[model samples]
Target chain A: MTDVEPLAVTPALEAHALSLVREGSRVLDDVSFTVAPGEIYALLGGNGAGKSTTLLTFLGFLSPSGGSVQVNGREVGADVAAARGAIAYLPEAATLYGHLDAYENLAYFLDLAGRRVDRAALEAALDQVALPPEARGRRMQTYSKGMRQKTAIALALLRDTPILLLDEPTSGLDPVAIDEFHAMVKALAAAGRTVLMVTHDVYGACQVADRVGLLRGGRLVGSFEAGPQGRIDTETVHAAFAARGAS
Target chain B: MSLVFRIAREEWRLWSRSRVVVIAALTIAVLVGVTSLLTARGVADQAANRTARQAEAEAAFFAQPDRHPHRMVHYGHYAFRTPPPLAVFDPGVDAVTGQSIFLEGHRQNTAMFADARSGADLGGFAALTPASLYQLLVPLLLIVLGHGIVLRERESGTLAVHLAQGQSGLTLMLGKALALAGVGGLLLLPVAALALAAIAGGEAPLAAVLLVGGYALYLAVWALFVLAVSLWLDRRSVALGMLVFAWLVTSLVVPRIAIDAASAAVEAPGKIESDLAMLSRQRAIGDGHNAADPAFEALRKQVLDQYGKQDVAQLPINWRGVVADYSEKKLTALMNEIAEDRMTREAAQSRVVTAFGIVSPALALGAASRALAGTDLATHHRFLRESEVLRYDFVQALNNLHARALTYADDAARSSDPEAEARTRVSAKAWSLLASFRFVPDPASARAARAVQPLGLLVFWLAVLCCAVVVGARRLRP
Candidate 1:
């Protein structure tokens, strides 16, 4: 073990051997990772790979069967609101109140995240995510999947949390929206925020992530560092994921 | 607009395509229909029994052996307010408010034998009528059908696709609410038709239309509320559990608890207390022509003074007539006061219950529907008041005959001699002069004043639910 004290320095997000058990089965087995400031880590997995479970557990929505999750070097589960306050989570296809307009949707989440954004700031956040001006006042019931996804991004931006956890963030976006989302993720990391994303798209993950980790059967099977100058092909990642799947 | 209709149609198609949903809808329709029919039948049977009993009581009163007017007052008549034709749709408080009242001279009787609260263990499980079906069961069905509208989309991974296509959660929730409202309208069709049938038959007024409108809006409120819950909870199972608990609390628990609290808050004087009070007051007032009392002596002296004669026999006006008039006025005052007090207590209880309508729309609708049906506490009070007035007139008419038709010497001698008493008894023709009791309900114009507060509360609930939908939509992330 490294002699470095886990608590001495504050990382954006750090999970030291976090484990979660459900119904006598270990869904997340001894997962350990450190997402330092300005780092983007993509969690790559197939079905039942414990990607969603790990994010949820880190949000303090689920208690770990064993191990600890920390955000800004502060322990999670012990202080749920404080831990949640530091992180913003975007579930796959985030469900919004359909009766409210986009602006109201953002406002509600901002309030929930213990931050208040004035209308101008709220509008700026929406604009940053590439949501149209006209869509702000229209009820979210009229919004498309891409527009809703943009609103979700706007919500997270309004929170201004140090860490972001996203599950299948680009799953249903159109090409343009997906590109805009990738650029937004890059910008967030550039701002010294840590991002932990779960994705199945190898190319998309390679484009946005600083390092990629493959998970199989509740365990992180492989970790690859994508250096700034180094190029990694999708075929190599697919082979590694398949080999782990076979094991 | 056509897109909305198309979406609504799609929802209908989707709902019908699910065998479970279709079966549930069918079951609700059948239950509402059967409940309507049974309640209507029950109302009709009750009306028939009341009418037959009323006619029998009248015949028996007229068929009696000739007796003194005071003795006839003690032999009271029974009058029952026949249930209205629309009461079949919503019995309202008919079961809680007694239907039959014993009307007699100098005494006010409580309306009795009409409480539905007693012995209602298992009877409450089976639907009593369409009112029960709409008030308790239909909203529950709507919740079951609509609670998964958004949650299922999210659960099955289709919600993201829908959102990606430019649809928002607000639009989805609204679409589902509109669709459920349509289903609610469908469920209401049979009952609306029944209410219309009553109006066309001349048994119900145009106010029945207002009843249908109120019920429709009330059910819509429930539909919107259910959709709101679905939007709020992340998991479909959690949404389902929460919605069911809400339905149970609103429909079953809250109203029962309110009823108990209201009853405890306002205690109504029992029938025995009222009877004894009337008896004591009557004795204190003095029985007219009974020479053993100070009140009779004062009455005799007043008659003589009014006629400017030294004795009752010497007065131009029949002294017996004067005595009968004086006695009845006193008794009438006492009975009226007692009746008024009882009515005041009952009204207080009803007001307390009505105040709870703000929390539960079911109570508001139930109260309003019953008021429109003319079967609530107010209507019961009206019937009793009218009966008392008629009883006074009937008794007084007989008293007038006893004074004018019979001589004073014969009237006084009847108490001592059986031969003179037989001679003193008024003829059957005199009995026919007394008017039959008739209950005339106030016109439609009058009912609005009584129903407006509850109707306003129902509207308030609808507005609150509309706000909830907006707030809920705003809370959705993406």
Candidate 2:
């Protein structure tokens, strides 16, 4: 039998020289990248490196001063609602209503996104994120940072959109919780979900991401991709990241 | 459900859970109920008292013994200003202006026995009426509860999430505003019930309905105002400060400023000045009591010529009664001229004050409320004018009796001879012939019409805010 090749697929997310000017300062300058369908791409940068700003542009929260960003082949600015409909966004240290329980917050956001989930399904998503069963019903204000992060992650998962944009996804989590979160993200990608996460942790990015893009001064400085071995080298990516930061 | 409904439901949920919001809403509701009951009772008592006193005064006047017609003219009747059925909701100028006027011949008495003169101190607070609660306190409560409806979403960073969830800023703002309008609707329940009661109690249905509708619109103005301010300002605290400041200016400060401004601009004569002016004008017509006064010499000559007699005693009718009848016509005309001038100036002052409603919506709402309640200055002026008409008609009827009923010989000699005095008096049965005064209120349609301009101004305010909301919603972003 003759083997057939796969058709070329559109990128799930794209930024063509995306530049953002806010209140007279360039936040993202000539930044460019693309995440293929179902690929897990991580953007690594230090503080004020415009990583979160990049995520916001994908969510259509900020308009680019130059160039453009697209989600699912539609320009974000042209069809913001359409773009937002295709993606689930988890902001850095996402805050759900402090007065509501985890289940209530999940229900509210899912409803906002025009999705309905049964109680069992809600519990399954929470369980997948390793949130404690006892804590799911308590107000988020009573939650610790890790618990809150898990609930927010569960909310994003329940959104069930094809594209995911996570900002500082594993922030304030324990080492064990971080590893669990990374595994969950990989599982989602394996299920053909597009994942774009921005973070400062090089090793964490190298561990779960199919490719790592290094960003500095609001520009994409370098990129690392996993070879046939299916994993990128952490040492190489770290050295390159550190070198860019020092420069 | 739709996006707006979802957002509104969420907002409603949050507010329901908040202790401060729940407590404040409950407190205002309670105040509404309490104030309505108290004001209703007060209005009923006042109406009953005036009605009873009016009947008693009329009965006593007709119970007098046989007397001269001029004596019956001096023993004039009392006209009590009956409270409109809706006065319980908005007392308007009733407290400041007199509720009763004493009517007599050859004299134009001012209205007397104002409620304010009876001295019930409200501790410097606005009189606690259902209208005041709806106009002033409800809006303040809405501000306290909802100033942070949109601000909280932004501050908590949920606004970005909401947008990313495919909800536009417009929907988000509209949803929150919808929730606030729902609260305002809840606050309107007591006022609606009060208005309905007024209508059921035989008040003008159109006016009562208009009163309720005006309040709903007024509260909506406040709701839109709160939402617009919340959406426009960035910081929650600053938004709150701005909202409270706006409340102070529109609700309290602007109303007083408008009054002061109107008073200054129109320069209405005070009661003392008007009375003295009326008295001074009256003196020029001569003492109506003295038949031989020089001012009436021409009048005396005219009457004698008309009768074809050289002397008053030779005439068929009593000359003194003729002089009294003729002088009264001149005097009433003079009094009316001055009173009309004063009313014209007062109406102008009212127009100036109401015109300021364009700047402050509270003034607009207030003028509309009072106009609909039939408690405004225009209605009071109607009472004054109608009462004067009754006075003139009744006094002339008695003057007619004076001319034809008694002989000239008896009238001229009555001061010296007791037998002549007895003969000068006609039967007390003549007093029964005079028509009794009953104050006729303006038609319900007219009262409703008076409210149209101010109501239109309220609608203008609401339209401007709605436009602002549209602009605000369009400009909204996280």
Candidate 3:
């Protein structure tokens, strides 16, 4: 038999090397990135490295000073709402209303997004994120950082969009929870969804990400791909990030 | 729109799940309910008390020992202001205006027994009526409940997530507004129901509906303002602080300042000036005693000419009737002119104060509610005018009775001779013929006139807020 044709992965999102300016200051300088279908792209950066700004630009939270961002092949600024519907964002710290339980928070978000999932479907989505069924009924005020993060993941899951943008998703979780979160991200990518994560957790990123990029002073300085036989070590990626800083 | 309702429902569920929101809502409902009940009972009791006193005063007037008609005119009658049924809801400025005036023959009396101010030395807190609660306290609670609608989401970074989930800023703002407006509707329900019940029971005017509508629109404006501020501000704390300041300025500070300015701009003639002017004018016109007084002498010549027998007797018509009619006409003219001037000044003041309703809708609503209740300055002026007319009627009726029942010679001699005084007294049955004072309010006509201005102002603000919501929605997007 003829060799099977390799599946061509299409980009779920693309940004045409954009710059975002705010109040006469360029926060994002010629940043370019893309997430292909079924790929995990880890955007690594330190404080003020413009990683958050770049994600916001892609999410249509800010207008680019120049160039453009696209989701599902549509320009972000031109049709922001339509573009945004194709992606889900879990911001840093992901504060849910303390007065609402996990299920209630999820329902509010779903309803706001014009989605009407039944209770069973909502519960199944929470179960997908490994959130305890019992904890879903408790107020978010009683939740730990890991539990809140899981609820955020549940919210992102319920949207069922093709792309996900998570900002420092593992920043405040314990080591075990961080590992579990990386597993969840890997599972999402394995299911043919594009996932972009902004983080300084190089080891965690190396564990889950197929490709890693270093962001420094509003520009990406290095890019690397993990080999299928063995994962790239965290120290090598960290050294590259540090070198970009030194430069 | 359906998505907005779904979000609103979810918000309501979340709000109900919060103990603080529930407690705050309960507190407002209870306060308004209790205040309304107390006001209704107070108004009913006051009306009963005034009715009893009016009966007693009428009885005492007719119970007097045998006396000349002129003596009865000087004795005068007391008219008590009847409170309107819906005054229980707002009682707007009712306590500031007097409730009773002593109407007499030759002069008009200023109303008495009104307390100019209510509440404590701080002066900001007025009486805790339904109107005050709706105007000041309910809006404060609304601001507290609504000021964090968007800001909280933004602060927690959920706003970006929400935006990413296909929620437009307009939809989000509408949802929050609906949620808070639901609470507002709840707060208004009991009072509105009470007002409706009062109307059904025929104790209140139909204009109570206009009052309720005014209040609803006012509260809605507050809710919209709070939500707009929430969408514009970046932090919950900033939104909350700004809304509280706006409430204070619009509801509390601006009304007091406007009233004071209006009062200063149109100075009302004081009671002493009016009383002195009436007394001096009466004395100058002779009290029909001084033959040298030109007005009285001219009146006497007319009476004599009409009689044609001139020595004050031998004519069929009583000279006493002619003199009484002339004196009554002169006094009525003077009082009417002064009353008209005072009313014009008060109207000017009211116009000035109402013009500021644009700055504070609370004032507009308050003024409109008071007018609908028949407890406003217009009502007070009505009472004074009606009382003056009734006084004129009563005194002139007694004068005509004197001309017919008693001889002119007996009337002229009765003051000096005790026996003639006994003969000069008319039968007490005549007093029963006198008309009792009744305040007939055309509520529909009055409400139609008063509602237009306040409703216009409310609509203007609504338009402004619609524009604000549009701007806020644009700003709220990620």
TM-score of each: 0.67, 0.95, 0.93
Candidate 1 or 2, higher DockQ? 2
Choose the strongest candidate by DockQ. 2
- Candidate 3's C-alpha lDDT? 0.77
Backbone clashes in model 3, listed as residue pairs: none
lDDT, candidate 3, B83-172, per-residue tens: 766777867656666577787777777742112422210111357777778877998888867888778778777777778787778887
Worst 10 residues of 1 chain B by lDDT: B114-123
- Candidate 2 TM-score versus the reference: 0.95
Which candidate tops lDDT?
Answer: 2
Model 1 has a clash total of 20
Residue B104, candidate 1: how far off, in angstroms? 2.6
- For residues B98-162, write the lDDT of model 1, one tens digit per residue: 57788776566664321343112111224477877888889878987888877876675545433
Q: Is candidate 1 or candidate 2 better by lDDT?
A: 2
In model 2, the Cα lDDT at residue B365 comes to: 82
Off by over 4 Å in 3: A1-10, A118-124, A227-235, B64-66, B112-125, B203-206, B289-295, B313-316
The lDDT values for all models are 0.75, 0.83, 0.77
Per-prediction TM-score, chain A only? 0.91, 0.96, 0.92
Off by over 4 Å in 2: A1-6, A227-229, B112-125
Candidate 2: true interface contacts recovered: 0.69
